[model samples]
Target: MSFFNLFTQKSSSKISDKKLKEMLESSTPPLLIDVRTPEEYSRGHISKSKNIPVQNFEDSIKKMGLKLDSPIVVYCQSGMRASQASKILNKLGFEEIYNLGGIGNWSYGLKR
Candidate 1:
């Protein structure tokens, strides 16, 4: 692989839309988190995703009592906050963390 390719390789935490769709359709789906403001989430969000603003990420996550090995998928308005939340999850010892980038990337129907 080229040097640039090595540096630009996608992280394992990155999940494609197709893969995400499959996961959501499966019997056991990952926990989907929208790391945006409550107001933003209230306007529109991916169906079944829980609103957990990145600012209150840790506290909310801790309160949920999720197991460390639980699969979690995070997203934001434009991907940045999702990335931030992924890092926090990693630091908090979460084993399966997937970043679904931005909500804009989701092709499925959303809930308002």
Candidate 2:
């Protein structure tokens, strides 16, 4: 891997939309996070998602009092920010992190 790949690389788990939808409806839904700016998130975001911008990602996650093993789902307007947040989550020892990529790719209803 090149040196720059460290910054651009993504986490291992990239979930399919259908699987994510099912997870959302299941009894134990993952902790969903929107790594977009508050204003962009205000426009529209996935239901059950919390807005935690990538820059503040680690601090916000720490404040949430979540467990290290809790399942987490993260997304952004585009996949880039989500990837960044996912890396932070991994470094923070979160075990089940899933990057759902771009919100624009989501086929389900968004919360306004």
Candidate 3:
């Protein structure tokens, strides 16, 4: 691997929408976050997914009152932003972070 790759590694953890739903239904659910624009989130988003725009991800997470090791699942309009957010979460000491990809990939419906 390149030297750059060693410093900027992406997380490998990802989950499908069905798995996300199942996890949500569990007694201990992961912290679901929508890393999309506020306007996009206002249009529609996954139920119980908090809108934390990717631009200010760190600040948003700090205000969420979550622990450093909280199980967090992040998504966006597409998978790109979620991937970036997952990297940030990993660096911030979040032990369990999962990228749920895009809301478009969600087959279980959304909340408007």
Candidate 4:
């Protein structure tokens, strides 16, 4: 089965950045999603991460070109936006969704 297949199953695992980093280092790295506004995302984000911006998430998911089954790791400037985005993704039927809480907790650093 491919990574996309994972989304078909239900995921109950919620992870932290330290655990998320470990997965990135040892396992398949989930899709790191930044759910802040575009301006906030442009300011800085985890390296190689994609910006979806919570305000436009429902309409922009397809445009974001994210793999449906890919393990999703979402984050925001604080934690609120990402929390909202997480619920949205879940309703969209994405399995294996994980929220990284917020950018403030990212220690590996960010990029513009």
Candidate 5:
């Protein structure tokens, strides 16, 4: 399936950056993930976002000890990696996965 198709197939799997910002303010915040490389993440990232490079996402998620249904939002330098990561998360049984597209599309600012 196309990357966009994945989001369209599941209502909970794709969220705009603006919506993600709003969701971050909720009482129960979703887990924010940066699916870029460690170096890319170190340069800058959303505050409170965990860096889990897409190449090692599965193992990283396993090490995180999160529940299968935990709410999660993933982003990358561009949308491609994030979409791939989101699909991986879905296959891993994460029910509330949100592909927040690219960090470049995030207008709220970043934390270096």
Candidate 6:
């Protein structure tokens, strides 16, 4: 890896399901993001999560008005899509980002 790649700060933070759940239960929850398609999101998603289809992530982020230091939790049906989205957000300068793996580990009930 290049010196920059090795020494540069990570684009996003990563958290496990348990830690994410705890944060969600706290008084203030992180900005939960579901990077799945609309159809997939409609099937079920974590409450309070904003659905931004992977295809439109770049476009959607522009309107979010979120700070780079804000904590963001991203997830998808199986984890692949969320992984890509996490990387994209990191590249865009979002600092505190967490890839919550997948919706499969969500202990809380779904919204839909």
Of candidate 1, the 10-residue stretch with the lowest lDDT total is: 3-12
lDDT of each: 0.88, 0.87, 0.86, 0.79, 0.86, 0.84
Candidate 4 structure lDDT: 0.79
Question: Which pairs of residues collide in candidate 2?
Answer: none
User: TM-score for all predictions?
Assistant: 0.87, 0.87, 0.86, 0.78, 0.86, 0.86
The digit string of per-residue lDDT tens for model 2 on 4-110 reads 65565545499888999999899999998999999999999998888899988888899989987788999998899999988898776677899999998789878
* Candidate 3 total steric clashes: 0
lDDT of candidate 6 at residue 51, scale 0 to 100:
93
User: Which stretches of candidate 3 lie above 4 Å from their native place?
Assistant: 1-12
Off by over 4 Å in 2: 1-10
Q: Write the per-residue lDDT of candidate 4 for residues 1-112, one digit (tens) a residue.
A: 4577556655435577789888777657778788888898888888868888888888888666767677888888878888888888877777678887879888988887
Q: Write the per-residue lDDT of candidate 1 for residues 3-52, one digit (tens) a residue.
A: 65455443338998889999998999999999999999999998889999
Evaluation by TM-score, superior candidate among 1 and 6: 1
* Residues 1-112 of candidate 3: C-alpha lDDT, one tens digit per residue: 4566567655649898889999999999988999999999999999999889999998878777788667899999889999989988877667688998888888988899
Better of 2 and 6 by lDDT: 2
What TM-score does model 3 achieve against the real structure?
0.86
Model 2 global lDDT (CA atoms, 0 to 1): 0.87
Note the clash tally of each candidate: 0, 0, 0, 0, 0, 0
Model 4 regions lying over 4 Å from their true place: 1-13, 64-67
